[model samples]
Target: MTQPTPDHHGIIYRRAALDEGYTDKQLTRRVDDATMTRIWSGAYVLNTGETRTPEELHRLTAIAAVTSSPDSGFALSHQSAGVLHGLSLLTPQLDRVHLSTGYATGARLEKRRHLHSGALDDADTVVVDGIRVTSLERTVVDIACSVGFAQALAAFDSALRNGADAAVIAEYLEGHKRGVGQARRALGHADAGAENAGESWGRAQLICAGLPTPRLQHEFYDDAGVFIARTDYDWLGKLAAEFDGMAKYQRHLADGETAFDAMRREKEREDALRRLGVMVIRWVWEDLRRNRVVPMVREWLDRLGIAA
Candidate 1:
């Protein structure tokens, strides 16, 4: 069996394997037995478990692809960089790894990777998870140029939450007008207070649905001024929206608590909010998938008789 070095980022390169005294046949056996996953031709990541979602596999591919090539030759960009930076990508393209090269590669497409050729200045790159990747500002500009408005807003919102400076994003946009206008529109909708990709996605849906923008991470208090809960989104006294996901559900758990216990705690929180006569709406991943979020949320807005 091959053991990865401390420096390895959850994957082992064949060259590194050889240096560690493993033969090709031995490594091949490991792959055959499900102990290793061959990500690229000569790159492997441990396969102790299955990739639960397409997003997980995409992230693994992006990181493994970085080590598959000559380390100094590729800089992670776009959604790949987002993955490395721990930023939430709403709907990332999973088919290809995105890389930036210092030289003019021009075409920007490869079978398993998309190589974007540009002037890669040191100032525009940052090392993340031991790999070179585009800075948050550059990443925002890159995704804004390529994806739809909602997807772009999700990336921008996550970027801000992960410490991307708004002024810095603007500074990078100078002289880089290819998609600056579109990016500006997305930025206008971006909120740093969006706690995760789900909230960002919800915000994007509200924007596309032509619903009034809701305040993010708003706190509420009871009649005696005791705190109730800090909501994911607030239409200020009208409606509060929570993008309900597994992550949100898990948060309901106290340490060592069971699933039912978590649900009980969440029920309590919801009840407390309702006793204040506040309308609360919750959506899950399925809502986003079927495009039902818009009409469903719109219904809530109308039913509540809230102008927003």
Candidate 2:
């Protein structure tokens, strides 16, 4: 077998492989031997034995779906385009590749591909990493209309942080009847201050539970005005909440600093906030998964005599 070559994006399509003088049998044998991964019907990516995140795998699959199709019928949309645009989706549908088509009249799902029919103008499409996809604002509005509130809020928050115009997103939602109510509400509360998907998700949970929306990325200073820390969620200058995802700690690690070292620094920062008479609450990913954030926060508020 000759050594196969993939394109710059590390994707090799069947037709391209055949045109390059590779036999169909060779491609089949490679897939059977686990040397190449069949991302879609005729698209392949070399297997390097490294596990890919769900987002990465879905991205490759979406690329394959678009490239392998016989015609230019659709562009990646919804959570598919969201991932490509670097938007964070709390609970994305990873198993299916979503494509938007202006020619089709409705939605269809088959063989792990979702075909959505909609009016996609020139303004609603963009090319990301060599693949056609819905623009950032369109992707956010699409996801907002198609999924749950928490997931929509996460995407909205991420889009805002990525410099997507809120007015443009609102314009996309204007007079759109599908999920405009919740999408509009999500946009109304979306904040660019959210540092990541986890913080956005935690805030969404609180809001869905009828809690007051907390101020995001609130900073604390010492008596002499020296900066102490910026919290994930701050309420009334009396309480602060931090989402304890491993990524959060990893992001703060300096050169030669272990995660433990970063954690120690975080503890000291929290201690400083405590000294300022602010109550600090921290929750991990498991808490969010188990739906304990609302009750836990409510309990803390009641115990601290803070008005909910």
Candidate 3:
């Protein structure tokens, strides 16, 4: 059995396969045998039986959507472009591949693609892995305009951290009139020090609830000037907040260290911070998702006599 080579984006176009001397019957047989999976019409990816992450699968589908589209005027946009740009999004809709054409053709949703029309200039687009996508700032602004405040805050934080020009994004926001107010608010609050969407969402909750803004990625040093730990959020040297996601432990795992080990290290760090007169509080992903962070933080703030 011969397997067809996919492109750089892991997409095997049927037209390219035909040009490579693969017959339709062979391709169909491979699909029947589950060796190849069709992501879009006339586009397939070799199914090696390895599980794909949601982002990875969505990116592949996005590539397939772009590959199968006859018109080249449209570029990957919105959440699709956000995926390509590596921006942290909150519960992004992966069911559709979002695209934007340069001209005003009006937005439409088809079988697998959501086509958006906007006035896109050359600077508004970039090529990622040979696929045309909206520029990072454009993608962030587009996302800010389309999604809610908290979700948009996450994207804006990520984009700023990724070196997207905040001024340009602000300029782009001025051009949009529909949801510019929310986008402006998010941009105003966006901080690059937020490491991920979880922290951004947490901060968003605090801000919307009229809580005092916390210093992000605040570092604590021991009495001897030794660096202790960096926290996700710090308020008035009285409280430090952490977003406790399992992925965080996994992401920061030291060499030869297990997740449990990472957690232990984190606990030790928290203890050190607490010894330095800082109250440490942590909330998990579920807490944030269920909107418990605000009240939890408020209680802590009230107990500590830190005015909200």
Candidate 4:
């Protein structure tokens, strides 16, 4: 078969060889430009102006393409599905593609692909752009079962905020009889106001320590009736607690700036809030995981004449 000329987007491996058989040597010789870039091992691009690949879409497409037999089917699983469904507040660190199927099938993938075996019901699954994916509720349950508690809570929060019904998820869990316990527990602890995983974990820690639950994503208004600032958590009356996630602050640091400019900005924000009669207590990742934060929080509450 004769090789087709490269299109405007350049030649992709699947398109170049799948349509008409083209030997590897012939395809390689066609692209004499050294500027041609290799995305994965086989995927290549000749034009630099070509649009970059969307990672989520690429993952989904790979899963669909790999399932060649009737017994071979895949569902987007875990955090990967969460990202595709827009239930993830933060980007996933791991790039592995997750797939579920009843039959074992293998393919060379650009990234690690995890496989799970089970009969997927209609309610637990949905089709997105011709690809089967775990439903929003199922995705949340899978995340709760697989990832850390903090990440689970964040996923739950994003799902809730995006119009996922907690009751529907609960019913799905009950009927499925798989991961029901985890679903129930996660539902009980899920807080939509958690902006990130660290804040969610910090809230859970405080609750476990018997400290009174503070207002989440609480907004503070100045005396002039203007919105001054908002905090992750705020103790009503006098003592105010704020969870300072390390991830939150590190996101603001410059590439190599050694000066404490970020610290100075935080101090300013705190002082402004304090001027409005709100006592600010900051908690970081280490403090949240340890027992010290509990007592420190309680002490601040007691000093402010607020019962803890």
| Candidate 4 per-residue C-alpha lDDT over 1-308 given as tens digits, one digit per residue, 9 for 90 to 100 | 34445433343664556466766765567455444444444555454455644554444334433333244456776666776676644335345666666343453344456666666777778875555778888777777665555566677877887778898777666754555565566677787787766666666666667778778888888878987777878888356666664346657788774347667666777888889888988877678667567788888877887776
lDDT of each: 0.79, 0.87, 0.90, 0.65
Q: Give lDDT tens digits, candidate 2, residues 1-308.
A: 46478887788988789998999999999999999988888888888889888998888888888887765858999989998998878878878888998763877997788888888899999999989999999999999998878788888999998889888999989858888899888888899898777888889889988887899989899999999989888888788999884468788789899989887888898899999999999898889999999998888878777777
What is candidate 2's local distance difference test score? 0.87
Per-model TM values vs. the true structure: 0.90, 0.93, 0.94, 0.68
Write the residue-wise lDDT of candidate 3 on 1-308 in tens digits: 77888987888999999999999999999999899988888999898779987788889999888867888878999999999888888888889999997877788888778889888999999999889999999998988998899999999999999999988998998889878899999999999999988899999999999999999998899999999988899998889998874568789788899989987888888889989999999998899889999999999999999998
Global local distance difference test of model 1: 0.79
How many collisions per candidate? 0, 0, 0, 0
lDDT of 1 by residue, 270-291 (tens): 7888999878888888888788
**What is the lDDT, from 0 to 100, of the residue 227 in candidate 3?**
97
Worst 10-residue stretch by lDDT in candidate 1?
Answer: 1-10
What range of 10 consecutive residues in model 2 has the weakest lDDT sum?
244-253
Superior candidate under TM-score, 3 versus 4? 3
**Candidate with maximal TM-score:** 3
- Candidate 2 regions with alpha-carbon error over 4 angstroms: 245-247
